[model samples]
Target: MSIKNRLIAMNFFQFFVWGAWLITIANFWFGTKQWEGTQFGLVFGTMGIASLFMPTLTGILADRWINAEKLYGILHILYALVLFYLPQIETPGNFIYVMLLAMCFYMPTIALSNSISYTALKNSSDSDVVKDFPPIRVWGTVGFIAAMWLTNLSGNKATAYQFYIAGIAAILLGLYAFTLPKCKPQHTKAEKSSFAESLGLEAFKLFGTYKMALFFIFSMFLGGALQLTNAYGDVFLDEFKNVPEYADSFVVKYSTIIMSISQVSETLFILAIPFFLKRFGIKQVMLISMVAWVLRFGLFAYGNPTDGLWMIITSCIVYGMAFDFFNISGSLFVETSTNAKIRSSAQGLFMMMTNGFGAVLGSFTSGWAIEKYFTHDGERDWHNIWLSFAAYSLVIAIAFAVLFKHKHNPNDVANVSH
Candidate 1:
């Protein structure tokens, strides 16, 4: 295969491994194993725990010692091994430990994938990477959607077998990674520096700036909103089956497929971001995201599998705005605002706030709320659960609108155009 095709395939399997189980695993926990709600919170929070430091540690290893592609391959292989063992584990505590280990290996590859792609494209003689990569990266979202659909169609959405599917894809990608063009380590030799500097700790300097600090702090809060729906949306839809009128609806019967619309919309909306950012600037773009989150949850709060199907559909569509608006725009904000020397590390820190800390907070709090207020005799009170989440989003939105100060400069937006 050509280099482009190889990279695309890598991106496909990258997300395919995640898509196979990420959204549907709550069903596996709730329906199959019948685990406690708090246990599921801990299980989902493993991603957040791993995200706390795995990416930075792995990035250091890739930069200073190992070839990027080789480390990527190794991580995937380890991740696949963990996935293979997941089906055999019966207890939630054991499951959480294994998943944490799995995430430790898996999360770093998200950044590594970008690193490898940028390296490959920069080295290529035929194309300019800046112009070529966005189009190529779109295929990653396509792969993610395909995996979600496949999981639903294969009857693995609510089964441990979703891990098996993700595992197999990960292993295949691990082997395939060896054949890709090699990415060299960034460091040639050890050099003396401050304790923080040696650890890629210079990224912390951004915390000294008031605006950067607030942006990151709010990013963490918003990041909390990011994973709550993914962890519970399918299970929420499936919960409607307990109601007599909606028990037999198509949505309750196939919640995974219905939820995949969010991914589909994500791909479509990502293309519009350049235009949106150009017109509104990052602050307004982020505000739009916060509002989208409110709608995303409120719709779910009011939606049902039968009569309120449109609300559910609207919730899924708004997810595109909620997710992409924050993540992509946040990345652009970092790209534009930070110095070149610590750009990669700064980006990693941004992810740490949103995905790492944010995910942990979201999973644990939402889990606790669901258990306390939304469950009665093991049946879910999805209406109240979703309403609580909507309220949380509203708080975050209001806080961000008042706290995050960025002047919308038409020229700054124009820079992205050129």
Candidate 2:
């Protein structure tokens, strides 16, 4: 296979492992197990908890001791082992620990995957990472969409089969990772580094800068919003089955497929990031994403499978921008700004903020808030649930506008692509 095809395959299964279950796991938790909302929230929180430390720790290893591909492969194999063990657990409380273990092995790979892809593209002769990476990354979204469709069509969305599919795919990807081009550690001991710098802690200095610091802080706030839909979107639509009027609706029957539209939207939006990031600065593009988030949640608050279905559809479409703008742009921002030696660690820091602290904040708080305020009598008031989320997003957008200070340097945007 050509280098591009190999990277494409890598990106495809990278997200495929996640797409198989991330959105639909709520169905397994709430529908299959009928667990408590708070515990279920912690289930998503596992990714956040793992992201808090694992990504940074692994980033250090990748920078210092291990080849990126080798580390990436090892994590996915460990992840598959944990996932294979998932269906055996019978309770939500017990599920959290195991899920956290799975996430520890899985979350860092996301950052590592980026490091791997970026390294491969930059190494390829005559290739432009800015121009080439987005196209390759789009397959990851395609992979995610494919997994959702498979889980839903195979009659396994609410069953343990989703974990099996993910586990099997993960094993395949893990083994495949070993065959990919080498992504060796950039920092070697011959540099004569100090203990702190030796640990790849140099990237942490990005926090000392006001711009990067505020950027990560807002990334955390938005990260809090990221999993809300993944945690509840499917169950929200599936809940319509309780109403006789909408019980037979297409959405209620195939909520996972419908939710996959967001992933579909991601593919298109992922392509557009290069344009948006270039035309506007990272800050402006991110501001647009925050606004899109408001519309996304606001639309969902009123959407139904019937007359209000357009709102639902629109909300899903909005998700692509709401997600890709921040995540892809933020990563590019990190890539362009940071020192090459610490880039992996810097990417891990970004993941830590968005997926780690942000995810934990979003998961734990949203879970508690929803149970306390919007859920009653074993039913969720999704409208209020989404509206409150919209309000949270709006606040973040406004704060970001006032606090973040960066002018669109065409050269910096130029750095992202070249």
Candidate 3:
């Protein structure tokens, strides 16, 4: 098989492992196990908690001690084992601990996968990562959509069977990773550095750089915006079932699939990243993402399952731009800015800010803010909730425009090389 195809397969299962359960886990937790809503909130928080440290820690290992692919394989296997144990647990408390462990094993591999892909692409004389990667990465979104469909269609969305599908795929992917192109540690004995530097902790010093620090700060804020939709998009749609007039609408019955349109749109937008980055540069591309977030929430604020369904659909479509432009382009920005020696570590820091601290910030603050301000009596005011979120995104976009200092350089497209 060709290298591109191999990487595509890797990306597919990488996200498939996540998609099989992520969107549907709420059903399993609430519908099947009858867990407390407060604890359920913490369940999603596991991703943030795990992302905080595991990705950077594993990135260090990939940079200094182990081959990137090998470490990637190990983490997935460990993740699968924990996932497989999840169905056996009876209590919500136990499930949270198990999920935390599963996240710890799984989150770091996201950065590792990027490291492996970039290294492989750079080594290929025929491949340009900026041009080739988005196409390959688009499959991960496809995989996510495919997994969501399989879970729902197979009647496993509200059952423990969802974990089985994810766990089995994870094990297969773990084994397949061993056969992938080897990504050996770059910092060998020939390179000289101090003990702290030898530990690959130098990646943390990226905070000391003005440009990189501001980029990460904005990334974290955007990450929070991404969580706003993910955390509430479905619930917003599902709540329409509460309205007698709109109870039978397609949006409510097929809320998951409706939300899947975002992922579907992601596949298209991912393929557009190369051109957008070439035309606009990284800062502008991310700024565009911030604006998309504004539209995403604004559309949702007034959308209904009936006459206003277009707004909902449009929000999902806008989601594609809001998500991909920052995530994919931001990674490319990291690739062009950082030294080769700390490539994996730099990716980890990006994930840390966006998925790690950013996710937690979004999840916790949004939940609290919604309850305190958007909820009246016992009912949630989704309109106000979404409006607040839209306002937040607009603020982020304006702040990002004023604060982040960078000039669009066309040569940046070519500079993303080893």
Candidate 4:
């Protein structure tokens, strides 16, 4: 296969491993295991905990000690092993423990995958990373959607079999990674630096600037917004089964498939980033994302499995804009605004803010809020829960607009090396 195709396959299975379970795990937890909502929030928060440090730690290893692909493969293999163990755990505490280990092994690979792909593409004579990488990365979403479909269609959406599907795919992807193009350590022989610098801690200095400080703060807030749906969307639909009228509806049985629409929308939105970034600039694009987030949650607040199904579908479609605009454009903002010396570290800090701190905040707080205000007679008030989320996003959007300031520059797009 050609280099692009190879990278596309790598991206595919990389996320397929995740797609097999990420969105649907809530079902297995709530529907199958009958776990509490607050506890479930902590489960997803494991991603936040893992993201807090693992990526930076692994990046250090990949940058100085090992080939990126090799390290990437090793992590995936370990991840698969941990995932396989999930089927044996019965208690919530044990499940969280096992899941944390799995996340430790898996989350870092997200960044590593990008590193490997970017290096490979840059090394290829015909490849242009800025132009080519987006197309290749889109396949990762396709893989995720495919895995979600497989899980739902096979009647494994609420079973431990989802882990098996994910684990086996991870094992295969891990082995396949060995044959990928080499991405050697770039800083193997770098000048002497402090222990902190060696571990990319120097990126923390970016916080000294007002703009970056505000941006990272908002990133954390927005990061909290991300896990809300992923942690609850599937099971939220599944809960409709309690109503006899909706129990057999496709929305409940095929909820994951419906959720896949968000990923499909993600691919389309990913392609539009450059134009939006060029025309509207980063701040405006980000504001658009914030507004979209409000709509995403607001629509969900009113959506149901039957007559209100369009709201759910529209909410899923709006998810693409709400998600991609902030994530993609935010990455570009980080790429353009930071100095090359600390660019990688800055990127890591960005991830730490969103996936790490933001996720933790979102997971724990939302969980508590749901448990406190949205739960009664052991049933969740998903409508109020969603409206609360919408209100939160609206507040953030207003704060971001009033507080953050950046002049529009077309050159930011030009300099992106497309």
lDDT of 3 at 380: 83
Off by over 4 Å in 2: none
Arrange candidates, best TM-score first.
Answer: 2, 3, 4, 1
Q: List the residue pairs that clash in candidate 3.
A: none
The lDDT values for all models are 0.83, 0.91, 0.89, 0.87
Off by over 4 Å in 1: 1-4, 122-132, 187-192, 338-343, 409-418
TM-score to native of every candidate shown: 0.92, 0.99, 0.97, 0.95
Candidate 4 backbone collisions, by pair: none
Best by lDDT: 2
Of the two candidates 1 and 4, the one with more favorable TM-score, higher being better, is 4
- Indicate the residue-level lDDT of 123 in model 3: 90
Residues 140-226 of candidate 2: C-alpha lDDT, one tens digit per residue: 999999999999999999999999999999999999999999999899777988778976799899989999889999999999999
Cα lDDT for residue 230, candidate 4: 87
| Candidates arranged by lDDT, highest first | 2, 3, 4, 1
Model 1, 327-371: lDDT tens digits are 877866775665444544566677778878998999998888888
Off-target runs (Cα >4 Å) in candidate 4 are 188-195, 338-344
What shift in Å separates residue 340 of candidate 1 from its native position after superposition?
Answer: 5.4
Per model, how many backbone clashes are there?
0, 1, 0, 0
Model 2 compared with the native: what TM-score?
A: 0.99
